[model samples]
Target: MTGRGADQRTPALLLAAVLLVGVNLRGAIAAVSPVLPEVRADLGLSPSSVSLVTTLPVLCFAAAAPAAAWFGRRVGARPGISWALLLLAVATVARVLGGPAVLLAGTVAIGLAMTVGNVLLPPVVKAGFGAAAGRVTGLYTAALAAGAALTAALTAPIAGLWGWRVGLAGWALLALAAAVLWRSAAGTADPTGPAPVTPAAAGRGPATGPSVWPHPVAWAVGLLLALQTMLYYAVTTWLPTLLVDRLEAGLPTGAAAASLFQLVGILGALLVPALIGRRRGQVGLGLVVGAGWVVLFAGLLAWPAGWGLWVTVGGLAQGAGVALSFTVIVLRAHDADAARRVSGMAQLVGYGIGATGPLLVGGLYGATGGWAVPLATLAGIGVLYAAVASVAGRPVTVGGPPSVRDGGSAPVGPAPAGGRPATPPGGR
Candidate 1:
């Protein structure tokens, strides 16, 4: 039927929109990093104040995640993402509209909009492509990394030619474009747009239920997600600044270095999933990633004066770690529904928890007048990651239909098993 054909195309279109939105997520924040001094000087900001501006969007991401997930289920992913894009576009322009205070306020909108996509995406994938969860998640996440990379690479140059305001406003156009695609593909009403919805489980509503929070599985996934996001945002927010201040790379080099770090991550993010997907040792892989994080943080702490190579190595390792972390989210959840739940839990708690990294790192740096303590903290977190990943990385499946796991929740709690339907904590 015509309807069925349109339905099939819907997921692909939504995916396209997701990719576009992902591209814009980092533009505002990453673009500002290389030019922090310029902005700070112009805005009369202290290091701590600048750091707050640098880190606020990520913090907002954590704060807004739960609300995003609830809104997605209550409204729909397509509708939610579409509206988010619209608001984000508006906010992107707003970032350029006024002084530091106004820009900071607008960043909140950007952060909130980004969270909507973060939480809803897993469920959207699960809802649309039930059987191909792994590949689909991999593809989607890779696209997200690609978006980050593109923005990271372009922001500084764009800002160089035009003022930061123009650079910031450009991203709004991309957000608008995504909004249009999302609308066309998803339709105007029912925001989820034609994705299949099964009957709600006994005493469970998709948006609000015992499933949303305070669940064991949710806690585990949330921890992992938070660890991943914390590291990623820390890098994004601080790397360029570090390169400029510590590595003596200067502004342009700092921006390029930061972008390169993320670029390496794009490769790792895409490749690690394929290599590890078939392995039965996800927990072990996580341990390895955690070890990598430890090494990364150690390198950062011990990085010699003018030793950009060490910094580069640190960035690559961190990128790989983050990519692996994301891969685990897909691997850990058994079905799309379970992935949705897991993604929601991880994002809600993970990002919320992760936001602490930036604030704490910035705060510590402010207190200490150096980066040593923050680097130490990052290493400490890495150690925790190793231990946790060791437990979480084992080859396991959970939450499928009755036929898959004999009608019980699987290892991570039932997607490849009995469909326990978890929500992504970050609001996915």
Candidate 2:
């Protein structure tokens, strides 16, 4: 009875750890945005350099994603998470003491650590909460949104009180605390810590399967995820600037608008997967989100003062867009190992592609000296996303589970559904 009780408690604790980890990941990125203006002033960074500061993490996400899968196979997920979280904490804490170069380097470390979390956490969730992926994903992503919102909203004030360095350093504390919590809660040895995948599933190298690359679902999910991430990071990096320059708003109001964008995004990220239970539901929501994107950009330009409501609409749409992308990550893969693979590939390609938004928009700004070009650039991506989602959002399975060859997966073939256990393609 005690053993069973302990078993039951383990999963709850693991979930908590995932939530904490999620919180740390985004705060590291979002906090910097709010404090970026001040950091720019302190460092005397040009607009292009500033764009690079925000762009570095996404680029790291792309570069380091494959490594995350490698680490999960070699070191085990819990240990990888622990070390990554510690790295994030240490890097964030120590980075602020130096010059802009140090700051950029620390962000690189943070991005790498975050990539591990991004790759490993979903599989861990799938292993533990097999019956409740949507709810768990919602909770996890909500924490992600909460972290971004909290940091986005608070960093400005924190910087005002102390300085941008302290505001930047503050996120390190969250990472540090998350590290401690993860150790205490989830650092236990096997059977109690993170659930492990089969030897064939996780241990196989990246080439074991042609499942995801050749499949249409993977491309769609990847495309959608990429575009949404591009939009999210672009706005997170530059939204404040847009509000301030375009609408002639004050800094605080612009910061608040940025904060509000993420805060409402939490709702969309949290609710979409749960509320829209059917697989095809995301497809339908794509149309809605597309329309909302139109409204979000257009409404902001047309009724600039009524920005609050428009912000909410835009936030909800983008949030739901992200939520759907994540859902597709889990839903489109056959198992936890596959989840990690799909996640790695999706984020790798997605973030790699998405990283261009900031530079392009910033270049546009530098060239045109206005927000119109940036706004058009963002809206144009939305238009492109509509076409991709129409296909990626379709009900289809990725190729199949990871082929173990002789000793790995058995009878490797097309996944039953788009990674679902029993459903077939388009079955719902």
Candidate 3:
């Protein structure tokens, strides 16, 4: 292919690879969760064992995230992800052997594979699309959601038709297919661009040396990601129960409300990021979205009527928050490797912090014997997130910020997940 033609074709290829990666990463996580009860019963697992099965992957995400950059740096991003998917497929399929040992080992391997993919995929996206970061990330994030939703929605039914093992391992076929397609399309890595440098070779360490952790902007993005993620997961965990128990809604009413929240949330997430595009400064949008969630909570608490409206708006803000968190990871870093490093820190600390949300909310509910205090506390988090979003909204690179504080420069942050800024493709 001619040079121009190769450039033209690469985005389509990258998008396919990215979308497939998205599908595979979350499928392994989501697929198992829905069938977990069946797996628990079949294995005769105790409650503690079941809880461990559920919690191990999340803990792995926190513990294994930093290694992702190290692994990606040594092997190159494309190879790292390709291999991770391969491992994910093998490990997921291994569960078909049917034993606790295999299940635990397979789950651990799946978590590792997903951690690598989660950390590295953004850098790959940035390297391939450059200016189209927002569009690519929006789509990628959306696909990740789709994968989870697809598996969660279907895994139970599939298990009912066949068996729990099939349901759990069936998604591995998607992973294997993705691995094969990615290998064929990439073919010893794309010829269109040179293999990117490793972080060590490229001196991707923060200016302070030893670590980028010292940088305030990095912390800003990391904290923003953590808080937003915490909120999303917490709401997801408790929303249905809150509807059914607190509001005295029927089981179907609660389930329907939760489904609406997810659907509207996904749509809103995809649409809201476009509004921010290239121009920076998301403080206004951040505050608006954050406060919107608070109002939704208050409205739900007060009247518990017109819930569909509040739920939709809350879901919109939730999706946008998560999407924008990923966008921040891309926008705050200067290059692909740097992006990976920043992603590592954000996800490591962010996910660890995020894992607390569900437990905390649940504990509070038990302690108070009422949703009032728990819901109010969640609303408080929304306002706190808005305040932090103002800081993260400032248009500054994480490790290479113009200064620690932007020197009173006009702040920047919002970018709708739609059109990407038109930077040169080779900018990274």
Whole-model lDDT per candidate:
0.64, 0.72, 0.73
Sliding window of 10 residues with minimal summed lDDT for model 1: 201-210
TM-score pick, better of 1 and 3: 3
The weakest ten consecutive residues by lDDT in model 3 span 405-414
Judging by lDDT against the true structure, name the best candidate: 3
Model 3: per-residue Cα lDDT over 139-258, one tens digit each? 777777778778878999999999988888888889988988776555445322333444452224542223456667677777887788778778777888888886788878887887
User: How much does each candidate deviate from the true structure in C-alpha RMSD?
Assistant: 5.5, 5.5, 4.6
lDDT of 1 by residue, 1-428 (tens): 23334346656676676566666666656666656766777778777778777677777766666566566665666567777888888998987788888878887888888878776666655555544444556555666667766665676688889977777678777888888876676555542343234454311344222343433434555687678777767766676777666767677876676666677666656656575646545666667667767776677677645335655555555655655555556666665445545665677577778877666777888999888888888888878877777755655544444564453335543243556544322123
Ranking by lDDT: 3, 2, 1
How badly does each model clash, as a count of residue pairs? Answer: 36, 4, 18
Distance from true location, Cα of 390 in model 3, Å: 1.5
Off by over 4 Å in 2: 1-9, 37-48, 156-163, 188-211, 238-253, 278-281, 364-377, 399-428
By lDDT, the better pick of 1 and 3 is 3
Best by TM-score: 3
